[model samples]
Target: MSQTITQETQTPTVPAAHEAPPRGGKLAGRVAFVTGGTRGIGAAISQALARQGATVASGYAGKTERAQDFLHDLQSAWAGHETEFSIHQGNIGNPEDCRRTIAEVIEKHGRLDILVNNAGITRDRVVSKMSDDDWQQVIDVNLSGAFYLSQAALKHMLERGTGRIVNVSSVIGEMGNIGQANYAASKAGLFGLTKTLAREAAFQLARDGKLDDDTIGVTVNAVTPGYVLTEMVQGVPDKVLDKIKGNIPVHRLARPSEIARVVHFLCADESGFITGQVWGVNGGQDM
Candidate 1:
């Protein structure tokens, strides 16, 4: 006769009430900086981050009146939130101003946990007809500006041993569209910049003297939002937008909040393992 052994399942262990509080918003206690965050997709990103309990500094290159109004709207939206929002005015296209803005955010917040390079302008024109000013202007703001800001923020982040950077690219960049040569070029450059920075940041984090630290790391990613109902995309004639929508598998343009949600997700602590990715927010639009 052989005796059979019975195994009993162990009871699960739960932390006592005094152990630690449950995690709040993924970005609670974090500070985020967003460029061109006064309106449209940028504003949506700022608001979404704030909703996640992150203090946000929104940079805008425009009139004070609009900036003030945007800030007021953001405050209203976050009436009950502990998140704080501050608006900064500067032209990120200028390296000096771009760096200054990042410096100012760190000065005010005492820390910078995330950076969203969401500022961009489209100077759409056929390659043959594009003017020097148009090409250079878009490039300056969309590509060069991102580089300047990222360089400034990386300094603080590397010192702190962790950070998140999200660059806003475009669907046009992947598949060039008609009359968008300069715009496409500027957006396309973001992909390379994002990937390179992600690699550099990862390497630095690994060597940051925190070999056994699980929380010491940096992540850099890019977002390509498809046609969205923003001031930028609304410039397209309704008929043209309709045709474009028809082509989308979702049969509609993306809401700015939808794109913002993805950005916020990428900036969360849970996304630490995700880096050097081009997270597309398009409605299944190819290329």
Candidate 2:
């Protein structure tokens, strides 16, 4: 005769009230620097990060009045909170300027937790018709500018052992379009830069004995947005704009805030596990 065996299931363990993490924005006490943060997609990103309790340093290459106005609006939107915000003027295409802006932000905020390379420009023309200036200008600002800022910011981040770098690319970079050779190349270059930096950051952390399962190491990632409804896009002819919308599977342009949501998600503390990834906020356009 064999005895019957009984097994009891064990309930999952839960942390005590005192051990649970506090309920609030994950980025509280963090500082973020956003290039081209005065308008369009960049402005949306600045607001998103701010909403998450991050102190924002918005970098602009425009008039002081515009930057001041943006700051006022941002503060007004988040009234009642002792919001800490600032604006930095610099030409992203200039390496020295990039370094200076990063230094300024760190000096003011005591730390830099996030860097968003959102400033970019376009000199649209067919490859045959495009002048050297047109090509060089786009590459300098769109691609080289990102590299400059990242290089400067990474030093602080690696030393701190935690940070997030988010590069704002474009759908055109993934899928080439007519009369946008320069733009396409610059955006596509971000993919390579993002992946390489991610690897380097991890390697350095491990070399410095800072790598561990519990540690959230620095991360670098790229975001590619498709057909956002911005000032430039709105300037297109009605027929052309309609054709563009028709081509998109979503049949509508993306709002700036939608793209910002993805960027904010990547910048969160919980997103440490993700790195060197190319996130497409294109509404099913590039899948």
* Winning model by TM-score: 2
Error of 1 at 100 (Å): 0.2
Tell me the TM-score of each prediction against the true structure: 0.88, 0.90
The reply for model 1, stretches above 4 Å from the true place, is 1-24, 211-213, 231-237
Q: Give a tens-digit lDDT track for model 2, residues 1-287.
A: 00100000001111122321222377899999999887877887887788788899999886778788878767666666755889999988899999999999999999999999999887778899999999999899999999999999999999999999999988888987778899889999999999999999999999999989988889999999887766555346777777777877889888777888899999998999999999997778786
- Tens digits of per-residue lDDT, candidate 1, 1-287, equal 00100000011111122222222488989999989886777877877787787998988887778778777766666665576879888887899999899989999999999999998877666789989998999899999999999999998998988899999998878876777787788889999999999999888777766324478378899998877765445345667777778888999888777888899999998888899999887889874
**Model 1 lDDT, full chain set:** 0.79
In model 1, the Cα lDDT at residue 268 comes to: 92
Clashing pairs in 1: none
Please, what's the RMSD in Å of model 1?
Answer: 14.5
State the lDDT at 83 in candidate 2.
Answer: 54
**How many Å off is the CA of 205 in candidate 1?**
1.7
